[model samples]
Target: PKRKTVEKHGRDLRDIIGQQQGKRALEIAAAGNHNLLFLGPPGTGKTMLASRLCDLLPEMSDEEAMETASVASLTQSEINEHNWKSRPFRSPHHSSSMAALVGGGSVPRPGEISLAHNGLLFLDEMPELDRKVLDSLREPLESGEIIISRAQGKTRFPARFQLVGALNPSPTGYYEGNQARTNPQAILRYLGRLSGPLLDRFD
Candidate 1:
């Protein structure tokens, strides 16, 4: 095997996510069968932390690598042209619509979440995402797959990927602040998007 050895790259996933619990959490996610949410303020390194998992993952197999590459190729041809070594990583903005996150256009292209199959879906500012769009994740979260039904037809894509989400404690993205008193409604409205069923599926 001419493959290069794994690189710590001056950091490990556990360091950014330091803690016994977090270490165990990373263990579960690496298995590619769990969902996770990070509750913290800004500059906490949630994105950087999840990014390091690629370095730790024992490089993808040919079939797993191809499936991942194919999805990425649907978005960018260059990524698929080369032989990929790591799993895909998708970070979608909060304002993106349901179709963009879960995948559905007239022609039915894969969305950010689908593009991240067999890899990671990092949703920064998870609460800031539209309620409908956030709620749309419930189905795939359970089935480990996403089914997009369009007027043309239905497309099923493998979505068995780990979900990593980061969100602010308050709508203002603060933890302890007097401003929270004035913006109480904003916090409630933002969190209100997460329904009971959806929340239940996450654990």
Candidate 2:
């Protein structure tokens, strides 16, 4: 059964046009459980490729599937009898606040990363995210879990999932060397939204 699943995934990968490099990177990331960053212009299938990663991954163990479903249930994520076994692939908007990504409130709850346990957490247009929100992931990325502390107590959520981020090379979504590109100073500031420390967490 597992072999058939992996074979089906391989066939799906073969259907992607061009981007041999992207396929190789995906293989490496999946094999080594490495975090990945995709920098490219729009319409390049960055999001599409990231979404297919879960399909390539091995089927979840029974315990892993159950734990993942529990988090989904806790987050009130529209769970039903079917589709509960599907591994999560959460992509919160760039405007999401630190609390939204990391989980916090008068009543603590699992955030996107937690909800993505045993699966993938994709951040598209990564630099558009608030620096603090991006930075909040640093610890959890390393620790493979998140601890949300409320006034009452702390709740821990599993976050041992692969991280995949996609971003355009420049704010203009075009080649940086283009004549009409934003000035160097402006470009630097734009990219600076992703701080050095936060980027350090990604492989």
TM-score of each: 0.81, 0.89
Give the lowest summed-lDDT range of ten residues in model 2. Answer: 3-12
For 20-128, candidate 1 gives per-residue lDDT tens digits of 5655666666666557776766776566666655555566778888888777778774573343756677788889988889988887887877787877788888877
**Global CA lDDT computed for model 2:** 0.82
Where does model 2 exceed 4 Å of error? 1-11, 80-83, 176-180
Best by TM-score: 2
Give lDDT: candidate 1, residue 80: 32
Which pairs clash inside model 1? none
- Expressed as tens digits, the lDDT of each residue in 1-203 for candidate 2 is 55533223223477899988888888888888888999888889899888878777776778988898888888778753554555677899999988789887788888889988998999999999988888889888889899988778888888888899999877888664554367778778878888888788778
Q: For model 2, which pairs clash?
A: none
